[model samples]
Target: MNIRQMIKENNRLQDAMTPDNLSYYQDMVVYIRSSAVQERQCEELLLEMARRLLDAQDKGKDAKDVFGNDLESYCKEQIERLPKRKGLSALQYHLMIPWIALTWFFFVQAIVGFVTMWAGGPVERMTQVRISTLILIAGGAYVLIHVLMKWMKSDAFKPEAAQRKISARNIGVYVAITVLILVAGVWLGRHLPVLVIAPWVSLFIFLIGLTGTKLLFSTK
Candidate 1:
């Protein structure tokens, strides 16, 4: 074939060898034509695409592994870049936040439960109203915790930030604890006021323990 005629035939054949076709002869011809420009080996692109597909499958199994690593890396960077004038040490400050959150939850729940009990158990048909209310409050708190975690997770380096997101979570836990205490108090208060004092004391104990744990871990 003449030079121009041969070039035209090659162009037509090259255009026909798309990835989806994987035709051997067509691929060989295109590979030769585009050798200088797209010098990748014949299967290079296909192999890379296969790797990406496998990676995607792995991510589907544990999306957290991909995003969580990024988040934790980001948090480390932020801590390292701090201006040093934030008062408390970075470790100390973040550590104490969870403790403070737990304490606040304990106190709030203790009060809510105490007040709820003091208002009298519940009406006849509304006997389960208190339980329902407590459940709703707890569910709402969980949602809030989830949202807060999602937002803080934007930092990409603080993957563990979500683990420490107990502010709203404490509310739900303490609320349940308080309700248990209130029920016990109501039952035992039939004879003495001692039962009324247990929940608060328990809450205080939990706060102390939580605070201690935070300090110990953060100091490391």
Candidate 2:
């Protein structure tokens, strides 16, 4: 199964745990996931842990006994033991965000261009790649890399029960940021040194980005 599927399965398995075991296991979940572990590797490790603990629980072994009483140390040890992705594979993995960002960023522009034509808005705005567009692309890549690198580490330090989960407010914040980028990009494209790109050119670049993203993230 894929990493996301494995994560979903792990969540499902949590339903079968005895109350006490579930609490201990979930603490481990938050801790391990919050650590500086690669996402695919982390999910694999968690799924394995889930099955092993579930089996032990069936035989009446408590989580503390099956793992250990020293939760922090145990989690740290696991982090040390886990394999790190390095070299080209690691580089490709990191490239995932930018490729995706380029793909969607242009895709959205293309749609906006079409909508503008329909609504009789400024036709030239869609074709102009502003200084802000370059800033947006570079800034977006930096922000995404920063967030991915820090997210788990940030959460690892939180109280287990207080760990952040994906919620509507968090999603709304993201949407707001995206909308701000689009508005700022359009406004800035008008004021300075801009490339005279056609809407079809934007569509072509968008397609290339989409194809590249698919290849970049495709499973080996």
Candidate 3:
């Protein structure tokens, strides 16, 4: 029978069932319908399941016996066995990457600017320097994260070769990086003359950094 007929029959059976039976049937239908399987295949699967339920009920078996106790888990297991559909196309990725990168860049800058202003960096010039420095840092970090993500996806970077255990060496490396960043920030704060740098310079650097990040991240 066609899917439409099967659906009508299933609805008729559901209408005749008890409240708890109806609820269970509805939940199972939802779980299966939400899966990535093709619409025709999903409908056929549901139709078969409904037929089995009706048969079991006629034999005087409980709903739990007809469709197991854990319907959700059963549905998940079945769906997992289905082959995955192809993900977004390259064109879609290209369209989306710039927007995603811009979002991250803006979010990081906003947080940095808020914290700097709250910390009482002089509103006139020092605040601008701090904000500029932060924008550059954030841009650099954004590029780094994308680079690392790419590297992680490479076949050369096998899961087995990855460091599963965190050791003192890793902890020490992190600490060293943190210290260097703090030192660099302090040095810039002290040595960089806030007034000597034009406001346009910061804007230009930010724009350049943003463009560089987009290019670095968007390339395959």
Each candidate: what lDDT? 0.43, 0.76, 0.59
Clashing pairs in 3: none
Pick by TM-score: 1 or 3, better one: 3
lDDT of 2 at 37: 74
TM-scores vs. true structure, each candidate: 0.24, 0.62, 0.38
Give candidate 3's whole-model lDDT.
0.59
Off by over 4 Å in 1: 1-84, 122-197, 202-220
Instruction: Provide the lDDT at 124 for model 2.
Output: 95
19-78 in candidate 2: lDDT tens per residue?
888888887888887666777888888888889899999898988887888776777888
User: In angstroms, what RMSD does candidate 3 have relative to the true structure?
Assistant: 12.3
Q: How many residue pairs clash per model?
A: 8, 0, 0
lDDT of 3 at 45: 75
- Model 2 bad stretches (over 4 Å): 1-12, 27-48, 51-62, 69-94, 153-157, 161-192, 216-219
